[model samples]
Target: MTQNERIFLPWWKRVVIVIATVIVFALQIMLFVFAFQVNFDFPFNVWIYWIIEGGSFVLVYHIIHRPILTNYKLTWSILILIFPLPFSLLYYLNQRSLALPKYKQKKIDTILGNYYNPNQIDCTLELDRKDPKAAKLARILRSSTGYPLWKNTKYTFLFDGLLKHEDMLVELKKATRYIFIECFIISDGKLLSELLPILKEKGDAGVEIKIIYDDLGSKATLKKKTILEIAQIKNCTFTNYNPLGLNINPAFNYRDHRKMVIIDGKTAYCGGDNLADEYIHQKKRFGFWRDNCGKYEGEAVQSFIALFIEMWYISTKMVLKLENYLCDYVLERETSYILPFGDGPSNGAEPGYDIFRSLISSADQTLYISTPYLIIDEAMIESIVLAAKSGVDVRILMPGIPDKKVAWYLGRFHYKDILLAGGKIYEYTPGFNHAKNIIVDGRYAFIGTINMDYRSLFLHYECGALILLDNEIYKMKDDFLKACDDSKPITYEDWKKRPWWQKLISYLLYLFAPLF
Candidate 1:
């Protein structure tokens, strides 16, 4: 079946499916309660009570001590306390890392060890001497992600999706050795139609092509024919990350949210645009789809190659030689320092969250952020509030036209706190602003696939590059300011005057923000 034809079900069928799912879920919950709470023979019942009481205590302790977000731990603790038996078992099951086996993890560590040992001590020391805040952020990112700070790197900010599409095609055609493309979503649309032919031609020409897309992310739009065509392409390997199944493991909650296009280990593209028609405006889902993408070369591209290698190993058990794909020559430009890094469930560290928090903490004059979702925890909110209260020009740009209403409402829930603390919030009046960007004092910038949501920060595999003291940061700042003019600002008065129904909806959704 064609992608457009098979992607959506009829209204009646969808309704039936929804009803069936709800019924089955309710029945399962009922059976679970009955199985757990029902009284048994005297001795057996006593033993069951002891096990439940003891296990609940231990699980609660472990949950509290887990190195996750404070809000996340609190929510899970409340759920466990309420449903001690089922939630305890569920927590244990969710903690298991079924997606990453021991060998694959060891392989990732082995691959990262090569790049981590040779930390750019000179670049770090120079940053420390010049700007201690930037130095501290760089040190934390390097230590957490094992991707060292790099100098002599070229960075280009692609503010428009169409520009990114054009630039990506040019880079793909120049690939003489290999191409690595990974995205959260890769649908069969105008974008993919234009892209697949080039990839197929390149693969036939002996340029190795590797592609990874999250199965759940693309399940609706990726056609069977598209998968087969990719499989049949010569010298091309397509692997889906974390296939959705009937398993009850927590891996199901995680996704490969990283997006990038790397060619010959010499050039790379990373940002928010996915391989979809809506992303580039061939077909618009929510008015004008405002997004940002970036193209870069030089030493930082090597780090992107390493991230691809690590994810490729996890998806396919075939290990790639780390040395085989690295760029041999450097561009030798002393413009700015860029550090490309990756984070996910493979390691317990929440580097994505840490990076965002650090950038927010280090903003001396101005902090500009653009994201599709603003679903963050209290700690991040505190950082934003602190920056605003300390007189930093903190501006956040969000989507006026939402693709997910619940998430949008949850985003609005935090507007009061920000506005009351002297921060400005703007919604892109033209359309859904899907770009994930952060510019600090026009001296530092972040451009990549990571969003300001819990999924992007805590649960998904994400990649991005931190640009420090670069001219590109000014471009990002300019773009952010121009976009802000196109957006509608939310003032304290406006927030207070919002509809009661909207406020209630946002309040209801706030409790589930972390999960979403």
Candidate 2:
């Protein structure tokens, strides 16, 4: 029924596909049957049990050796005990492939280091003169990840996805040379209908365009033909970040979750909104669709440009010179400091999580957050509780109507302790809230794609903007306060009063949340 092209498979291709499917199913069944043999009392069963145990031990050794979070290692080790063969195979598959290919890493480091002009000296002096705490954080970020403190960057905080789309269009229209877009999801609907026209107009006018979308994230909404059509546009190239295919590889879990738009390497946008109708409430599925994004201009755009280039090279195997794309025009001076940072398989240091941890550690008056998921690691739990117990007002705004129910219930298991430690948890009464936001003391703000969860912080590629002394910081704080006013707050007593069955299920879900 759709106007798009459809593929009619040939007999040979169909036969190959059928053969692959049958083989995969057969392998899975064999694994299950062999696993079942551990319960039998034959000599062959003894050999099977020992073989699986030996494989699990080998996997446990590697898991212990991996420089991952202690909680993650512990979870995998426990799973290895319960289902030795499958869990061990999972560990063996995941641990080895978590790091990017050597050639890809080399390419990223070369582009990230050589082409980036962080403007560090001037930023360090500015930090020392104005905010000492921010200066310490800048040092931590710089050492951990080379993202430098940017000066004179103007920030526009868009609390709604529609508003962000408005600004994005304005910026997209102004692009004379290049436009780079990377996102987790893209669907054909109101937002894409509006966006494709602009991108087409630009591409026809000789502007270069590049795009990368996560394959698994946009599986249903984006068809392969749509990408092919876009690739045919002049100077336009596009690729799926990680192609989801028939192979049963654990590496698919490490997705590109970052949503970044860079126009001419001068203006950039990063936030929670993806290219979907729900983000803008065009045709809402869950009630009122709440989201947020930040538009940045000036020196901070360089970091975003660098991020796009890194991804573009990885996906397309084509690297462009950063100097050619630098914003040639000077930006208006502003008083705020901005640092655009990214986290991914490219580095061992989790820059996104570390930034949030620093923000929590630095909170003086208030620590506010909004995220769809509340899956936090042990270190983050300690940070939140410690911050609240130290007398800071820690308030978190999570979604009421969840996209995933099991994880939503599991999130409640974490609420009891934080509520006791002077933390407040509120659920949006209207619908889903997909904003990844954090504000510290109404003076500093962080808004971007870094969700406060295990999958986002540890596994997926992510990006965020660190705002200091920006007037928009107050706006960020106000948005959270307004959400709180409209939401239902959960008390410690209420958290403790959850039914025993719910508690048991939540705890059960929580045990395996690290992998989620």
Candidate 3:
């Protein structure tokens, strides 16, 4: 079926596709096992079983000793122990693929050198003179991700995709040098319908345009013809990062979940909104779709430029001239630091997770978090609980209505703990709160696509901006407070009194939280 047809497929046809996909997936596993068994025919099968069993133990031991997260180790260990042959092989392959090949890494490192300035460390050093605690966090972010702390950057809070859509067009139309757009999902919807013409006009006018999206994430909504048309534009290039094929590997889970729109390296937008109709509320999949995106300027825009180029190199393996894209633009200066960084499973460091933990840990008076998915790990849970226990006014805002019921249920599983620890939990009554934001003591904020979930924190290629002492933070805080007003608070007593079935389901799902 054509891509457009897939989107408009009859319900029964879509159901058939889902069922067939599951069946094929199961068959693939079975065939893999069958092949393994057949390799050791007859009498040797018994010996091979013993060898496999021994190998499984060794793998389990290795997983335990690995310098990975506890949850990941548990998930892999359980799978390897339960299904030795396939899971063992899968684990081995996954470990081998976690890092980029030496040549690719060398090439990317070389590309990155074009953007780094040794003097930028002075930004962090200057921050130390103002707020030592914030400076410490900045140092950690710099050390872990190599993304510098940008000073005097202008930041704007686009409360929803509709607002972001307006700002994006304004910037896109003003593009003189180049435009880079990357999103997790880009569909044949109102957003894309509006964006393509501008891109075409600019591309034909000798302005470079680069676009990237996740193949699996957009396959259901983006048409093949749309992709072809985008590629056909003059001076335009498009990539569906980590394209799907018959090859089954852990790489499938590592999607490019980052979203950004950069114009001339002078301005950029990053946040939870994908290039879809629902994001801008042009087509309502749920109730009013609540989301956010931040428009950025100043030295910080350079970090976003570097981020796009990094992903571009990873996806296309052809590094564009860095000098061609990096533009040093002046900004209407604000006294805030913006650190734009990208994280992924391949990066060997969990900057997203670390930043979340750091933000939570640094909160003194108040901590407010907004995430569509609150399915977080134990470390995150402990940090929030500890903050609340230490007299911090911690409030977590989650979706009242869910796009994914299982994730919603899993999120509720931890509400009781936070509630008991004096942390407030609210469900947005208007609709899904799709924004991934964290505000600390009204002084620091994170506005980006890194959700408080395992997939975003540890698996996907995610990006976001960490803003320190930005005036826009008050705007974000006000929005959060207003959202809290529209939300329904969850009391510990009420949570304990939930339906038995929901409790049972949540508990069952909690066991597999890492995988989700």
User: TM-scores of the models, in the given order?
Assistant: 0.89, 0.89, 0.89
Question: What pairs collide in candidate 3?
Answer: none
Regions of candidate 2 where Cα sits further than 4 Å from its true position: 1-45, 248-250
Lowest-scoring 10 consecutive residues by lDDT in candidate 2? 1-10
Candidate 3 runs further than 4 Å off: 1-42, 89-99, 332-334
Among all windows of 10 consecutive residues in model 3, the one with the lowest summed lDDT is 1-10
lDDT of each: 0.83, 0.81, 0.83
lDDT of 1: 0.83
Ranking by lDDT: 3, 1, 2
By lDDT, the better pick of 1 and 2 is 1
lDDT by residue for model 1 (400-459), tens: 999998899889989988999999999999999999998999988788888899878877
The TM-score ranking, best first, is 3, 2, 1
Q: After superposition, how far is residue 139 of candidate 3 from its true place, in Å?
A: 0.7
lDDT of 3 by residue, 1-516 (tens): 122321243455446545644664465457557756776567477566667766776877787676666556666766776678987776755552453666877788788875675558687787888888878877778878988888857899999889989888988999998999999999898888898899999998999888999998999998889888989999998888988888766576588999999999889999999999999888867788999989998778888988898899989998877777777676656468888999985466778888889999999999999999999866678789999999999999999989998899899999988999999999998889999999999988899999998878877899998888788999999999999999999999889998998899998887578767
RMSD, one per candidate, in order? 9.3, 10.8, 9.5
